[model samples]
Target chain A: MPQREGSPWRGLNVVFFRELFDHLTSVRMLVLEFLVVLFGAAVVYFAAEQIRNTTAEDPFLFLRLFAPPGQSLLSFVVVISILVPIMSIGLGFDAVNGEYNRRTMSRILSQPIYRDALLFGKFLAGLTTLTICLVTLWLLVIGFGLLRLGIPPGAEEIGRLLIFLLVTIAYAGVWLALSLLLSVVFRSTATAALVALGLWLFLSLLWPALAQMLGGVISPPDIRFAQLGLPTPDTLAWQQGLSRLSPGTLYGEAVVAMLNPDAQSMTTLLAQFQGRIGSPLPLDESIVQAWPQIVSLIAGTILLYVVGYVAFQRQEVRA
Target chain B: MTDNVIEASALTKRYGRATAVDGISFTVGRGEIFGLLGPNGAGKTTTILMMLGLTDVTAGTVRVLGHDPVREPLQVKRVVGYLPDTVGFYDYMTAEDNLRYTAALIGIPLADRDKRITSALERVGLQDVGHKHVGAFSRGMRQRLGLAEILMKDVSVAILDEPTSGLDPHATSELLEMIRSLKRDGVAVLLSSHLLERVQSVCDRVALFHSGRIALLGTVPELAREVLGGGYNVEVEADGEGLALRFSEIGGVKAVDQSGPARYRLLADRDVRPQAAAAVVNAGGALRRLSVEEPSLDAIYNHYFETHGGQNAAA
Candidate 1:
């Protein structure tokens, strides 16, 4: 490409193209992409088949039992939650430190490109790869949804899915930034990888359980608190409020509210949504209801990413 | 020299309590092969790194091509090519691929890259080995490949650290020849090497680095003149005793030594050869042998250690 004069980011295009070409041509990403798609398709096909065999009388209801009514979007969201973090950590974690170890950082830093270009190039590359993977997963899910339901999703469903994708991108951005930050913070690839993996595991899997344990320790179920306890009506509300502090649970709750707009009552939010289109509820109605949790997820993702970017910018590239 | 290619003024680098490079100042003139001669840990690598902007300078300024390296690093780095002492390449790539990668990374034009790559490899005498995997190449070949990579930049200055460190005599000769060729092309080279003889032969000037400062800096001939004055010896079969009497009478003759029957070595300040030869002829003696001795780089190095002491010899 052509270099832009008087621009510090002139060589940013070079870093971008280099990373994009390497990732696209790499055997590991190609193999993982293929395996993840194939596995996801197989699982969706088998689940659709099983739903057809048992719940043929009322497919929508059966779908509601497993997912929300008229939408098997839960499968896609769950798959994304699991795979996005993996893609994030896999692509990053070595972006900076690996260059230092390979002695290529000297060559790269010696170029006209600033360090900002290098960091931004890596961040964008990882985000772009994860987005492509998520889009592929979306197409497959919608294709299967059409085949099984014999109906294309309407404007409302598509809009919700789009929102879901944006939120998912934000979520992936958090981890991408974290991985890049860790890559610079550590001198070795293995150490950075371990730190990234550990963070992913804590946020995705263990964070919710740890929140519950904290809740129990702070407000034990057996103890009779005057306001909020097991026997008291406020106990459930207390537990729900405590659980929202976990990032995983907060993101899951936001996805549920976005997917099931009619599930207004807290009890039915978990039971499953049953609603039709054309008598569309105001977007704010659902947003206001889930505003606390969704805002938390968005804010958390942005906050984490900013911290990572700042740390990365301050890191010394010398090994 | 009116054109100074590289200049460092009191450049210092300290890693916590340890001072890696300590207030070393030197200037390299355009098209000159300037050698930074020092032992290991004499801050040669650190000095090179600081000049290249790879490490932070704790104290003073470094100017390359009239740009402060720390502030206007990209400007200086763009026009300067550096080869670290232990050059490491992306092992999975072939020689051509590696060079092409470097060419692209440095923003070499796509249209001219192939020609540049071919010419650079050919210059390093690696034209036949261009297709081989760099990982499989011998250390000498790697060194040549590293040189080729820098040569593609066609930079105004080249900083090389121990370019012939692990090479055999033949390989070292090839590398020295390559460096000398760069000088012919008007590329100013600042290299640190332990090969004193090669430095003495190829470099027009040198700086003997000790404890992060230049102990001596000048042309080899200029240094030889300072460290070693004029000296000569004439061995005669006959009339040598009378010749000594005549030469001692001459103001130019300083001292005389006799080792054998027809062998005598003399020390003097100026050319007394015509007078001494005439004195021998007049005294009826045949001048069998005549020679003059000059100090070698080895002796200068030994003198450096002797005067500077062993503690700072390898500084």
Candidate 2:
């Protein structure tokens, strides 16, 4: 066999190009981004226009409501929060399974490249495309906000917006890792996509509410007889802890903290639980405060990716 | 295993409870066009997959180019280019794009990729259609493209699972020529096919896969010997059965049978055409005509299946 010496990064570079070219030209990828853009444009245009036309005092109510004459970290996170997971799922749900279905898995596995190259290459390519799309969306949103409001973001606001971008990407990475696991587990691309969407829906919409109800049912705390029954402390704590386990909740809370540190009143609970809580920090500070959540998001993503790697390595692509 | 570039030892691959490839053993030597001949669902694809490390071996060891396919897959894969039974290409891309993609995935350097792609396309006689979308290509063209993808890597071994399966006669001939070309390049090729003619045309050596085992393994002539009981059959047109019997009693004749009213078949271990002819003529039988027929490979292949009914034959 002909052997050539090269750096390990060279391998990754090859994989990255292959995947990126595929993603760039793939019909499905085009369909997905087109739909996202169409829907996003509609949502932003109609909502902002309606609000601007109705609230005559501030034509750029959406921008001012989220951030006062600055880059609204809240607005960016909200838009990305809606867009990130969708893009991640769209990019990743079929990454491995599609290869398996196309019967290319064997041909690819028969190559000299490592499985890591395939999986990591796909993620990096998707991340690159996603970053480009998100940044463009940010510029557009900020440009429109500037045109309407005629002010740039302050230093503190920009810092918050940067943190929001970081956390949002971290959140999106978690989903990307998740979809990879599903792709490895399910041989059919459609089935993997369905399973990923199901997981996304369950975590984002259904699981938190279910956890709250479950905590209430499992251990109903004593309530004062004077007022109607309300959520008790132990119930609240159980709910909070249980919700933390849901990746969706962790991602959402992190984004909210990064965008708007005072979005929720966590101080009273911290004071009650830890007994020596300090004043609330700024939005950026809150992202630092929620380092464990960020770590958990990343750790969860990596852990799933590792599991997927092992599963794929064990798979018999001959089928 | 000593001379064989790939040695599969009692390979067995089971999916849940369904056995895909039963315990099978075989060896492929250098520069040999080894044909794994079998019908569909006969475990030929599974066997090739195991050899290429595409499937887990339930119970066996597969060594490709002196490395375990399962454990040291990258090493084996580096030296082997596999064309799956049904070659699926990225439909949206051009043939050139697909080649580039495969080359990259196989770790070919960017500078080398262009040269490899060009040469590979040319090798498959697909140079002009390089820029055409694969979705528009016919099944035969796709098969050739698949072959080009593997050839581009410049690997020492090519494992083709049913290489000429869906090709027309012309395409089949072209594909076979390509396979023959591999031998000239000193690349060992392992191809599986049910088309006897295809195999007969290109394969230097062949193995008849029956129930996941190599029932008959040898060159076409060797297999013909084992299957049809190697020898020449002498047919003599005689005047009478008595004279034919006398001819059969000749020292060199193994057996004799009356195939027709005037025709007698003499089975001999060697060429005894002259002896049989003389005996027939001296025995007072008019020898109208004499002809010799060599046993065919197809007959040998049929006898292999006939003798070995299933995997139970070994027991």
Evaluated with lDDT, which candidate comes out highest?
Answer: 2
Query: Per-residue lDDT tens digits of candidate 1, residues A174-224?
Result: 677778888888889999999888877886677777666666666556555
lDDT of candidate 1 over B91-199, digit per residue (tens): 7778998887778767899999999999999999999989888889888888888889889989989888888888888988898899999988899999988767666
lDDT string for model 2 (B1-315, tens) is: 477898888889888898777788888899889888876777898888777766777998888889887666677888998888778887777999878877876767788889889999999989999999988998889888988987888878999988888788898888889889988998999998887765776788888776666677888766765566645678888684476668667775677888888888887656678887778777777778989876555667677767766644554
For model 2, the superposed segments whose C-alpha errors exceed 4 Å read A1-10, A30-79, A225-230, A271-280, B1-3, B10-23, B58-60, B231-258, B261-298, B310-315
> Which candidate wins on TM-score?
2
Interface RMSD of each: 5.5, 5.6
Where's the lowest-lDDT run of ten residues in candidate 2 chain A?
Answer: A1-10
Q: Return the clash pairs for model 1, or none.
A: B42-B315
